[model samples]
Target: MNLENAQVQMRKGILEYCILHIISRGEVYASTMLEELTAAKIMVVEGTLYPLLTRLKNSGLLDYKWVESSSGPPRKYYILTESGRQFLSQLQTTWEELQFSVNEIVAKESKGE
Candidate 1:
């Protein structure tokens, strides 16, 4: 596959985790989230992000409030729930372990071990 297709394939698996981590950092509106993800070189459309946000909310991992904007209609700002913080903690541990293991494997292979 081409580089773009390959990148998309790789991002598909980790996008949800990355999104959650970003949201967990602070309350953010959908547009801001999209901007942040794009800046990080992770392209996510509203179609993808909205559904993921809905699922996270449904799972009680996210809470949102409608905040009135000065220029436009009210915007929904999402924040991590208590459960989300706990869940993210667990995910962080798992991610660290996976990263360590993958790094070890790559290092060994590179060394012809």
Candidate 2:
């Protein structure tokens, strides 16, 4: 199997969690979100981000409002909804548990046991 593909898939799997964390910090526009993700090495494109944003919006996990920009047309700034905040809290707990489990397994494997 392709290791690079696996790595990409792993990143994709955690994207929603990362996005929620970002939104939790504050309201964000798409370009800002893209820049943050790129800086974090997630390597996302608009094609990927827009659909995910739409899906989250439809699912009641995110909401947006248009803000006029001095440079051009209005921009949509996305923020997490109440439901989204609750869901993110749950995700955070799940992440902690999974991280602890994975670390334990990796430690054991590294010891050749």
Largest lDDT belongs to which candidate?
A: 2
lDDT of each: 0.90, 0.93
Instruction: Compose the digit string of candidate 2's lDDT tens values, residues 58-106.
Output: 9999999999999999999999999999999999999999999999987
RMSD of each candidate relative to the true structure:
2.0, 1.3
Winning candidate number (TM-score): 2
The deviation in Å at residue 93 for candidate 2 is: 0.6
TM-score, one value per model: 0.89, 0.95
Q: Which 10-residue span in candidate 2 carries the lowest summed lDDT?
A: 104-113
Candidate 2: clashing residue pairs, number: 0
Which stretches of candidate 1 lie above 4 Å from their native place?
A: 1-4, 109-113
In the predicted model 1, the residue pairs found to clash are none
Compose the digit string of candidate 1's lDDT tens values, residues 1-113: 59989999888778878878989879899999899899998989999999999999999999899999999999999999999999988988988999999999877755546
